[model samples]
Target: MLVLGLQGSPRRKSNTFILLDRFLQEARTKGCQTFMLEVCRKQILPCKELVICEKNGECPLLDDMHDQIYTLLRRADVVVMATPIFFYNVPAQLKALIDRTQTLWARKYRLALTDPKRSFRKGFVLAQGATRGKNLFEGLQLTTKYFFDAIGATPAGNLYYWKIEKPGDMAAHPTFSEDVRKAAADLLDPLVRRRRVLFVDRDGAGLAPMAWAFCQIHAGDRIDADFAGIAPAGTLRPFLETAMTAKGIDMGFFRPQSINELAPSFSPQQVVALGADVMETVASRFEKDPVEMTCWELPTFDTQDSEQISRLCKAIEEKVQESFGMA
Candidate 1:
C-alpha cells in the first residue's frame, strides 16, 4: 500500500510535522510505501476558476502543482493531511491545492468518469492546535471530507490534538506514539492480508492495469492487485486508457510508479511478468522460493493495435484467474 502525507505546517519540525512523520514511520514499519509532500514549501497557486478542467478533464494551469502534486494524489492508496490548525481550518496553501482538484470532481460527476482508485482508497487528517476550541477541527474536517471525495478517497479517520503549543508538545503526550502505532496497524492489517500485489513493467502498462481491473471485478473479495513499472513511464498511453474505459475501468487517475519502492512492501505469492524484459527484472529484484512467474509477449499500448490490446487483456485475465486458482 502507498500512503501520501501532505504536511501543511509552515514551521518545519513543528508539532504537526512531527506527528505526521511519526504516523508515516509507523505506516512504513507496517509495510507501506510512504511519501510526504511539504505543501508550505511548494508553489501552489490558488484556483483561478478556470473551467477548462471541467470541459477537458484537466486543469489549464502550468505550474509545479499540476505537474507534480496532482498525479501523486491520484496514485496514493491512502492520503493523510497533517496541518496545525490555522484559524480553525487548513493552511491556505493546502486549501488552494484542494480547490484545484475541482477538475477531478468535474470529471467524476459531470463527465461520468470514475477513478478506479476511489473504490478502495482511504484518507485521513492529522491536526494540532494550541487552543482547545471545540470547533477547531470542525471546519478542517468538513473541507477534508469534500477534498477526499473529489480525489476518490473515503475519509477514514483523523488524529487531532489540542493545547500543543510548544515545538515538542506532542512528544510529551502520554499516548501519542502508542496511538499512532495502533492507527498504522489498523490501516495496514486489512490491506496486507487481503490485497494481491501486481509488479509490472512499462511494457505491461497496457496489460497490467487491465488484469488488475479484472481481478478486482471478479475476485476482489479474495484479491487486491496493484501495478508498478521497473522503468516507469510519464503517463499511461491514451489508447490504453481508452481501451480500459471500454471495459468499465476508469484510467483517468492512472500513473506510473517505481517498482523499487513497491516491491519491498509486496512479497507477492504470484508474479506475472508480461514480457521477457519484465520477467528478468522481477527475477533479479525478488529471489524467493520460486513463485509462479508467467511470461507473456504483450506489447505496450504504444506498439499494439486495438485488436491486439483486446486479445492481450483477455489472455492476461485468464492467466490471473489461473494463478489465483480461480480457473
Candidate 2:
C-alpha cells in the first residue's frame, strides 16, 4: 500500500511535523510505501475563486500543486494531512493545496468523471493546536472532510493534539506517539491483508459487472473484485442485472464506474479486462504494476441477443472459476 503524508506546518520541526512523521513511520513499519511532502516548503497557489476548474476540470493557476502534489495525491492509497492550527483552522499553505483539489471535485461532480481506484482509498487528519479551546479543531476538521472528499478518499481517522505549542512539545506528550501509531495501524490494517482485482470494459454497463458478480459469489472471501468502465455510461445494464439474477446473483450495487482518472489509489493488483480495448485503457492509466496487467482472449458477445448474453455469462463464470484455482 502507498501512504502519502502531507505536512502543513510552516514552522521547522514543529509539533505538527513530528505528529505526521510518527504516523508515517508507523505506517512504514507495517510494510507500506510511504512518501512525505512538506506543503509549506512547496509553492501552492491559493484558489482565486475564478471557477475555471469547475468548468475546465483543470486549475488555471500554475504551481507545485499541478506539477507535484496532485500526482502524490493520486498515487496514494492512504493520505494523511497534518497541520498546525492557524486561527482555528489549517495553515495557509495546506489550505492552498486543499483548494486546488477543486479540479478533482469538478471532474467528478461536474464532468461526471469517476476515479476507478476511489473505492478503497482512505484519508486521515493529524492536527495540533496551541490552545485547548472548545472549538480549536472544529473548523479544520470540517475543511479536512471536504478536502478528502474532493480527492475521492473517505476520512477514516484523525489525531488532534491540544495545548502543544513548542517545537518538541508533541514528543513530550505521553499519549501523542501512541495515538499516531494506533491511527496509522487502524488506517492501514485492511489494505495489507487482501489482494484486489478490478474488471474493466468499454462501459461498466456490460461484461465487467458480470465478471465481478460471478467472482463475488464464488470467491468473495479470497480477493477484492470490482468493475469499472473506460467511459462510464452512468447507468446499470438492466439486462445484465436480470441475467445475473437468473443465475441467483443479485447485482443491485453494480453501478457504472469510470476507469481511474489518475493511477488508482488501489494499486494495479490484477485487472481483468473484457477485451483488448479495456486492457489498453488500463495500461495507459497504470504503468507501475506491469506484472498484474494481462489480457485474456475471448470471443465478444452481443448484448442485444439473449442467447449470446447467457453464453457470455457462462464463459465469464468459467474464467472466474479458473482465476480462483490460479489464486
Candidate 3:
C-alpha cells in the first residue's frame, strides 16, 4: 500500500510538517510505502478557470502538476493532506492542488470514465490551527470532502488540533505522537487485514486484466488485488476494453507491466496464474514464502469476436470470485 502525504506548510520544520512527518512515519511502521510532497516547494499553478477540464478533462497550465502530481493522486492508496489552518482553511499552495483535481472530476462525471483503483482508495486530513475555535476545521473539512469525492476516494479519518502555532509545539505536546500513531492504525488496519491476491497471465492484454478489473469491482474491499504479465503487450486489447466498458468499468490508466517489474515490491499471499507458462516464472521469482498458487485453464478464443470476448470475461470474473471466496 502507498500512503501519499501532501505537506502544505511553507516552512521547512513547521508544526504542520512535524505532525505530517510523524503521521507518515507511523504509517511506514504499519507496512506501507510513504511518499511526501512538499506542496509549497513545488510549482503548482492555480486553476486558470479556462474550463478546459470540463471540456476535455485536460488542464492547460503546464507545471509539476501536469508533469507528475496528477498521476500520484490517482495511484495513491491513501492520500493525507496536512496543513496548518490559514484563515480557517488550507494554505494557498495545497488549495491549488485541490482545485486542479477538477480534471479528475470532469473525467468521472462529464466524460463518464473511472479510475480503476478509485473504489478502494481513501483520503484523510491532518490539520492544526493557532486558536481553539469551535469551527476551526469546518471549512477545511468540507473542502476535503469535495476533494475526496472528486478523486473518487472515501473520506476515511481526520485529526485536527488547535492552539499549536509555533515550531516544535506539536512535538512538545504530550498526546500528539500517541494520537498520530492511533490514527494511523485505525485508518490502515482494515486495509492491511485484507488478503493480497496477484493475478498473472501470459501477455497482460486479455484475461489477467479482466480478472483484476472485476476483482477490483466486486471484492476490492475484501481482497487487495494486483495483476501483471510474464510478457506484457504494449497496451490492452480493444475487445477487452470494450467488454469492460459494457460492464460499466472504464479501464482508465491501465498499464501493462512484466512480473519482474512488480515482484520486487508486491508480496502476494495468494497467486492465481491464468496461463501455465507464467506459473514457473512466478514461482521462481516469488521463492521467499510459500505463496498459495493455482492455475486455471481458460478457453482460448479469437480476440476480435465480441461474443467470445464477453464470454471470456464472464469466465474470468467467475474464476476470480471462486478463487477469492467471493462466490
Candidate 4:
C-alpha cells in the first residue's frame, strides 16, 4: 500500500516527526511503499477562498501544493497526518493544507463526483502534545476528520502521545515502537489478505476505470479491484466519464496513476491487461512473479462509438467473472 504521511511539525526532527517516521518505517517494513510530506517545508499556499473549486470543481491556485500534494493524496491508499498539538489544535501550516482541501469537498458535494477509490482508502492522524490535557487533541481530531472527508478517506484511526516535549522524547516512550507496529499491521492486514485484486495498465482514464467499476458492481464484496496505468494521463477521459455515468458508476474524482506507484501496494492474484499494449508492459515488468497475467482486448478511445464501448464492457465483465472463478 502507498502510505502518505503529512509531517505537520515546523521544527526539524521534532517529536511529531519522530512518531510519524516510526509509523511510516513500520509500514514500509510490512511491505508498504511510503512517502512523507513535510508541510512546513513545502510551499503550500493557503486557500484564498476563491470559490472556484466550489463552482467548477478545480482549484485556481497553481503552485507546488496543487501540482504535487493533490496528486499524492489522490494516489495514496492510506494517508497519515501527523501534528504536534499547538494551543489545543494542529500547526498553522497543516491547517492551511487542510483548508485547501475544501476544493475537493466542493467537487464531491457540489459536482456529485464520486471517487470509487475513496471507498477503499483510509486516513489516520498522529499527534503529540507537551501537556496532558483532557481535550488536547480534540480540535486536531475534528479538523482531521473533516480534512479526511475532503480528501475522500475514511477516518480509520489515530495515534496520540501526550507530555512529550523534547526532540527525541518519543524515542524514549516505552510503548512507542509497539504502538507504531500495531498501527501498521492493523492498517495492512486486511488489505494484503484480500481474496482477489485486479490491475489495469492504461491511463486508468477510460478502459481501466470502467472495468474496475464493472467488477465492483458484479462481484460486490466478493472481490477487491484496483486500476493503474504505466504512464498515467493524470485525469480520466471525458467520454469515459460520461459512458460510466450511464451504468450508474460515478467517475468524477478519478485520477490517473502509474503502475510503479501502485505495484507495492497490492499483490494481485490475477492481473488483467485492458489491451495488448498493457499486456506487454506488465509482462516486461513482472515477468518473474508467479501471478497470472492475462489480456482483454478492449477498444481504444479512437473508436469513440457507444456500440463499441458496450461490446467492450460486456467482454470485460465476462473476463472478470471468469477470473473470479464465477464463470
Candidate 5:
C-alpha cells in the first residue's frame, strides 16, 4: 500500500510537520511505501474557475497540478493531510491544492469515469490548533469530508490536537507516541487484511488488465486484485479502453506493470495466468510463500474487430466471476 502525506504548514519545521512526519514514519514501519509532499513548497496555483475541468474533464493549468499531483492523488491507497488550523480551516496554500482537486471531482462526477482504486482508497486528517476552542476542528473536518469525496477516498480518521502552537509543542503532548501508533494501526490494518489476487499475461497489454478490472468490479470488497505481465508492453493494448467504456467502466488510469517489477514487493495469495508462457514465467520467478496458481487458455483474435474485443471481455469477466465469487 502507498501512504501519501500532504504537509500543509508553510514552515517546514512547524508542529504540523513534526506530527505528519512521525505519522508517516509509523506507516513506513508497517511495510507501506510512504511519501510526504510539502504543499506550501510546491508550485500549485489556485484554481482559476476555468470550467474546463467540468466541460472536458481536463485541467488547463500547465503546472505541477497537471504534471504530477493528479496522478499521485489517483494512485494513492491512503492519503493523509496534515495541517495547522488557520482560522478554523486550512492554510491558503493547502486550500489551493484542495481547490485544484476540482479537476478530479469533475472527472468522476461530470465525465462519469471511475478510478480502479476508488473503492478502497482511504483519506485522513491531522490538525493542530493554538487555541482550546470547542469548535477548533469543525470547519476543517467539514471541508475535509467533502475533499475526501471529491478524491474518491472515504474519510477514515482525524487526529486533532489543541493548544499546540510552538515548534515543539506537539511532541510534548501526553500520549503523543501512543496516539500515532494506534491511529496508524487503525487506518492500515484493514487494508492488509483483504485477500490478494494477481493476474498475469504475456504483455499485460490486454488480457491481464481486463481480468483484474473485472475481478475488482465484481468482488473488490473481498479481494485486492492486481495485474502485471511477464514482459510488460508498457501500455494497454489498442481498443482496450473502448471495450471497457462500452461496459460503463473507465480504463484511462490503468497502466501495465511488470511481474519482475512488482514481485519484489507484492506477494499474492492467488495467481491467474492468461497463458502457459505467463504461467511458466510466474512459476520460475515468484519466490513468495505458498501461492495458488491457475492458467487460462488464450484465443487468437484480430484487435481491430470490435466483436472480437467484446467476446474477449466477456470471456475474461466470466473467468473472473468463476474464480472469485461474484459480488
Candidate 6:
C-alpha cells in the first residue's frame, strides 16, 4: 500500500516533523511504501471559494494542488496528516491543501462516481499543542474527518499530544512512541490495495467473459471485477453468447476489449491470467510486475458443449474469490 504523509509544519526541524518521521519509519517497517510532501515548502494557494467544482468536479485554479495531489490521493491506500496545532487548528498551508479537495468531494457527490480503491483506503492524523486544554484538538479533528471523507478514506486513528512546545517535546512523553507505533500498524496493516482484480484469457471469447460476468453478479459489491484479452477477438462466438443467455447473464453488448485500450492510469491490483505467457505481457506494462497475478491453465472446451460452458464459468468464479481474497 502507498502511505502518503502531508507534513504541515512551517518551522524546520519542529516537533511535528520528529513525530511524523518516527511514524513513517514504523510504516516502512510494516511493508508500506511511504511518501512525504512538506506542505509549507509547497506553493499551494488559498481556495478561491469558487463552486466550479460543484458543477464540473474540477478546480479552475492554476495552482500546484490542481492536479498533483489528486494523483497522489488516487494512488494512496492510506493518508497521514501531521501538523502542530497553530491556534487550536492546523496551519494555513495545510488548510489550503485540504480546501482544494472540494474537487474530489464534488466527484463523489455530484458526479456520483466512485474510485474502485476508495472502499479500502484509510486516513490518520497526528497533532501536537503547547497548551493542555480539553478542546485543544477539537477543531483539528473535525477538519481531518471531513478531509478524509472527501478523499474516500475512513478516519482510522490519531495521535494527539498536549503541552508539547519544543522541537523534541514528544520524546519526553512516556507513551508517545508506543501510541504512534500502534497507529502505524493499524493504518498500514494490509500494505497493498488488493480489491480490484482483472481477469485475462486467450480472447474474451468464453472463459474470461463468463468469469467476469458471474463475479459481477455474485460478489460485485465486495470486489471490482473486470476482464480483457491478451488477444481480443472483437466479439464473442454465437455459441458462447447463447450459452450466457441460457444462464440469464447478458452477453449481448459484450465486445472484446484490449488491456492497452484502457485508461493510462488503469492497472488492476490483482490479475488472473488463464493462459500461458500472459504475465510476461501484462508485467511489461507495470512495475508491480504481476505480484497478485497468477496463471490458471485449464482444459479448453469446445464451443459446442453447452454444459461445459456452465462448468468453466463456475470454476473460474470459485477461483476468483479464493485467489483474490474477495468477500
Candidate 6 structure lDDT: 0.74
Task: List per-prediction Cα lDDT, in the order shown.
Answer: 0.77, 0.77, 0.85, 0.79, 0.85, 0.74
lDDT tens per residue, model 6, 156-259? 88888989998778777788888888878765655433356677776766667666666655654455556778778967767766666555454533466677
Local lDDT at 274 for model 1: 63
**TM-score of predicted structure 1:** 0.87
Per-residue lDDT of model 4, residues 1-327, tens digit only: 468999999999899888899988888776666899999998878899999989977887887667788877866778999999989888898888888889778867887766655777789888989998778888887888889998889998988998999888988999998998898789767764555566685676777877776675565345566778878896888777767665545565557767786776676677878889879988887788778887887555454688877676677778777767767
**Prediction RMSDs, each to the true structure:** 2.9, 9.0, 2.7, 3.1, 2.4, 9.3
lDDT (tens digit, per residue) of candidate 5 on 1-327: 568999999986989888889999998787666789989988998999999999877888888877678867875789999999999999999999999999888878998987777788899999999999899999998899989999989999989999999888998988877898899999987776778888999888788888888887777667777788888886688688778877867565457888877776567888898888778878877545689988899787788999998998898898888877672
Residue 248 Cα positional deviation in candidate 3, in Å, after optimal superposition: 2.0
Candidate 1 structure lDDT: 0.77
| Window of ten residues with lowest summed lDDT in model 1 | 295-304
Roughly what TM-score does model 3 have, to 2 decimal places? 0.87
Tell me which residue pairs clash in candidate 5.
none
Candidate 3 vs candidate 6: which has greater lDDT? 3
Instruction: TM-score winner between 1 and 6, please give it.
Output: 1
TM-score: which is higher, 3 or 6?
A: 3
Candidate 5 positional error at 143, Å? 1.7
Q: Report the error of model 6 at residue 118, Å.
A: 2.1
lDDT of 6 at 129: 93
Q: lDDT (0-100) at residue 252 of candidate 6?
A: 38
User: What RMSD value applies to candidate 3?
Assistant: 2.7
- TM-score, model 2 to reference: 0.65
Estimated TM-score per prediction?
0.87, 0.65, 0.87, 0.85, 0.89, 0.66
Off by over 4 Å in 1: 201-204, 216-224, 258-266, 288-290, 296-327
